[model samples]
Target chain A: MTNISRRDLLKSSAVTAAGATAGLTGIASASNHGKHNHSKSKRVVIVGGGIGGATAAQYLKKMDSDIDVTLIEANKNYHTCFMSNEVIGGVRPMDSIEFNYDKLAEKGIKVVFGSVINIDPDKQRVITKDNKVFSYDRAIVSPGIDFKYDEIEGYSKEVSETSIPHAWKAGPQTAMLLKQLQEMKDGGTFVIVTPPNPFRCPPGPYERASLVAAYFKKHKPNSKVVILDPKEKFSKFGLFMDGWKRHYGYGTDKSIITWIGKEAGGTVSKVDVATKTVTAEAGEFKADVLNIIPPQKAGPIAFETDLVGDLDWCSVDHKTFESTIHKNIHVIGDASIASPMPKSGYSANSQAKVCAAAIASSLNGVPMPDPSWVNTCYSIIAPKDGVSVAMVYAYKDGKIIKVKGSGGLTGPYNAEDRKREELYAHSWFNNITADIFG
Target chain B: MKQTKLILIGSALLASSTFINLAHATVIDRATILANTCAGCHGPNGISNGPLTPSIAGLPKNYISESMYDFATGKRPSTVMQRIAKGYTDADIKALSDYFSKLPKKATEPKKTNNHHGHNH
Candidate 1:
């Protein structure tokens, strides 16, 4: 094929040269984005459609043209693992947090709607629950996390399935929990039990309590919210306490929500799903509705693939995201053990981009680019008011560590600045959601 | 499995590159393993004297390497560090830490402020 398209290519290359003059960057040329020509293209199979998997699909498509990506998700629609707490409080419509795979499909990501029953790393093939098999050159698993039902006594998956609901993954159960909260009468007690450390979203349960109380303060007025925890403090304890006080009469007899750290006799020992009661070291409290977000581990695929060692999360080459157990397999998002990186949507999205670049470079003959990343996690406290922690990182000394003079928490203040931060946080969330899914 | 990867990566590094890092690397010829992008904020010599920055020079090589290893492995979580260290190796970390640790601390006119905490040992 004596393609005179070279002339067109040369012209476009000149246009690209001109665009570069204006600081515009296009798809890395090594990637193949041609029509029905994926035969020679490299394939990246991403498992799970949560923050990490979804963002990886989008960013991988964005960074290169030739990467044929197939995203495997059991659910056709994904209700965000983030922001489900707000749904419990009836702040935002559950529909607002729900997403379809259409966006990824539009971006050329092949959506395989089936549960990944097995990950054959050696074969570089994934078998789904539907008995379908798809092979790839590389596999990226970001299967978020699963709860450890056995960790807490009297509370297991079957128990939650029938009566008490974890509502952690935020689907029908999230709606069910919200419905239960809505039907509670005045002066009713809302009990939220939080799990011990090494869980997804450390500050999530507290935020749920705060947001639920935010709803109750306006609607029920006499309702009380109690938080029984396994930890002494949380991500933004001081800020949370201040915000609670300002909004929900916290620290007062009339406080809408009361948080009992472990020191305050809040460690939960057992739960009775039938009676809707939680027995903790502090006291045995019964609630009209119980929301328990449990401790987590890397999803079943991570364990089944033998990716995780002693830890419950996958071990990866922090720089490349390649799993320690398998050469061509990379694990990102909440599934992998990225210690210095939280399992938040934003962090997972950021990680996916870096991993995509590395994978692309490795696929081609070029050396990997010098990887740098930025992350900011935003939490909605009292509606538009939000807070965030932003940082920029560089790799050094063979490990990924923070560069000084870069990152800091939002603030320990309760002034106008914090409110402004909330607005910024909301904007950041909108931007990030767009950056990840849109 | 981690041990295997570390060993495999170590042998790969040793087999691939002949040069090793010493005290300080000049801007132009920083080794591929050294990847002096760390110099952007930590200082060219690994010692940070800026008001808000921590000094990293003269720290034990493993200490420096361990910190990075934590970030890379997710024992620690920072927004940037996780992304930056997503794809590094044991040899790379060792080489980079030695390069920075041996370099003389960056020179600056010292100021008397709350440079109080020595290091979070």
Candidate 2:
């Protein structure tokens, strides 16, 4: 009840005034040390060291080196989901996509490898699983997406781990799925179950299907890849259909890749793990390798922090990314609902920078600068063939709107252009990882 | 570094000279924020690591603005730049050109000793 009034106050105040209040709070806390004490460096604690959290940490330091930043992540290393599809398709090693916080630490960000148990908005502190309490003037949570395992019958987290692989989080699950695909019979089917909309990486399922088909075509010519979708269409639909038709005999009797949209009874209701069968409205599919990507919501940490109140995702201010539900707490990455901007790693990284700038300015009692964001998601369809969709965004009329005529899909598939996009996609991975963890 | 010293001297000169760029100072800061988004693929300071994504750091101011103008106007052939370029205003392009052209082209690649995961398309 009090938080509603606080949110109203924040909404009514000028941008700098909200930050000025935070600045005053910093001074008030620091002056508690002694009567003659000087103001301490403002402390920012970030939970979840994914693309958004990592980028915010690094950029906050860059904006003002005097600010003390501490980043807490559960895992010592991060396995990026962006290019993990390449690993699943056997185009690159898993180690290539794996990154650590060593570079972020080198930038003077305190990288703590521990699970965050709680973020107390009232106390302005973050509590870890081991009872470690970190006080902060501001906090950012970038907890990525979590799956609703119960959405499908006979499928849960345990089943996803051991039997059917989601491989959405891009770690051992990826390796497991890859091993199954490799060991599969040459004429067998690799079934991929697609999730609904508002999920991380909108085009991810199609990309996975493309790469797997490529793998099957090379090593097991008689094998096929089947995608059962819950939606009528997907990201870059035309581009993907073209690529599939050109390379995988899609729409032909000998097609290696078959896409069943919702209209075609692609909505799956159950999976028989014991028999490796997927039951969709279209029909039942028996497969040698099954990849089930279940529906998703914000990660557990977001829910644990009470950031998402009766919603699947966190609500944030378009300009500052500060939570609309809570004060002084910002959420970015896949956990926050940023429509018009797909939940891609590039969008997370871009949002992180804007969020960081807002936090930095707010802490210093300065007006938040105007914000701009851009996202370019590149997906490799097959070797030497990649496609991309890009957009530039601006904050207008209290909402994030895409700049008209600014972004588009990769033009008509020229081999040279496709080849170049593939290269850029790899380079993008290199540069973005470097920007975040490096 | 020499760059910092030059920047300091430049600021001192700007303070003494006509306040022509005073109005542009905030615009420059906004442009810097806009430009930071490019580092995801272009690398920090616009010095790219990948062969295809060219380094735009330290290029001539005129050249940078001209190229961006071309990209925005569809005169230049680019895979993603045209879409990206059309997003910025002419003022943003000018400010970005001025900001990036002044920085050194070189940036330290993140320390990676063992993992060399560069794969060809």
Candidate 3:
């Protein structure tokens, strides 16, 4: 029998702390010695180091010390797309939202900076762009969302790069959009095109408009934000409209922000890059600053791996988040078909935990437990004026469904309530990021 | 001799019951899985170090169970908990309450104060 030392006991206790301070040396020695008495070491490979991928990696190691986890991400730093809207409004610096993988590494999760070129489910191996192959007993893919630039005419990848900026990915495009909004002349029109349903962050476009309006209210008084949305109703529509009327004069002609839903010809088909104009079904609208958020589907990696079938998003067993098409592969976050759960950072984080638990149990040859999922999306309308919607879900009748009489919006809008919700929003961000990254 | 046999049987039953209790304490499977979801905000095992969220570990099982019932039934007003509570059935809530109430209480430490940027969702 292998003798366990005091240091080993300390290491084991630290694992209960969510593996935040657990050292990689302990994991290395365990694998080298094969101390767990398993027939073979179990390996888990996670693609993408975003919220879902990173959380899964950390939780997997925390749940079971014997499993080897390798996380493959294309970028060294991951900038969250969730709060990038605030960056465009000049509320936060780019570096504030950027995160490195060093903390995950400290938790004994191997972080590999490389783009995955292909995944062979039959062979249970993932090949990276640099010609490296990682074999895994189970693999998790969470590459996030990619824009379908072809959905809109006269708007291509080059156009998005040069003249217009989507700012959806929370990086250079975000910076570019900020620069344009800052440089626009007073009273100049700023047009934002909202994508269709099943997009990331259902309330994102409205929140973007609110933040931009807040900026215009402070910096450029006469400037206006015109939202051209394909969908008629949006998440928290009533609350947003109420907040707009209360804060920004929504219904008035001199209102700083104007929203044209699909009923009002808000469906944009093409963009005139030279004129800085977008042609919607209703009419042609020109803007000094054009921010067109195009339609989206699963990320490119999903396509490369054939994880997605005829549908744009990959389908998974609602209980375990395991891909229905492929065995031993799990898909989570925005890339998977998780309905009733919007594709938000919080949703991804929640899904990651459930997936992590399922993966850990499966590896241990234990029965998978009943799963529950939760999502809360809080949007800041104007600084202290915030509103939120939350829901808890459970696996029922072979599908994940929302539990009725559960989640509701922030009741009875008041200044004190809004302020508290805003504080909670910020605290939630801090808590969740620390949970996933650490 | 009959008395001795009776005593032996009694001792064996007691030992088996004790063994079962020990197994229940160490083996965390379904209950842990369900309760871990709360750790995202409540802290590990419901010992929330954060000021806004409360620590729920080691509370009376009846209190925890009743509070969850209130949230599920809309008797309690909540921002997120109401929705989360609705997901659980009465039986599930009982199991969770029982599991969390048995955890050893830990002192609440102040969460690391950091200037957090961005909206998570």
| DockQ of every candidate | 0.02, 0.26, 0.15
Candidate 3 residue-wise lDDT at A179: 92
Give a tens-digit lDDT track for model 2, residues A305-423.
88999999999999989998889899999999888888999999999999988887766555576889989999989999989999999999888999987998989989877987888
lDDT of 3 by residue, A249-322 (tens): 99998799999999999999999899989999899999999999999999998898888999889999888899
- lDDT (tens digit, per residue) of candidate 1 on A1-438: 122322355346545653453322332233222222222336788988887888778766654545678999988887876778778879778897877888889878998888988888877788888787777778899988889887677899887776788888878888888988999998899998898877777678878888889889889999999999989988767768887888888888989998888998998878887888988889898999887777789999888888897888898988889998898899998887776766776667767867876776665434565666555655666764566665666666656676565555665554554555554444344445555666
Least accurate 10 contiguous residues by lDDT in model 2 chain A: A25-34
How high is the lDDT of residue B9 in model 2?
Answer: 23
Cα lDDT tens digits, model 2, B16-89, are 43211111101115876888888998887677767567677888999889888887776777777877889888
What interface RMSD, in Å and to 1 decimal, does model 3 have? 12.5
Question: What is candidate 2's local distance difference test score?
Answer: 0.82
TM-score of chain A of 3: 0.91
Candidate 1, residue A151: lDDT: 66
lDDT of model 2, residue A250: 94
Interface RMSD of each: 16.3, 10.8, 12.5
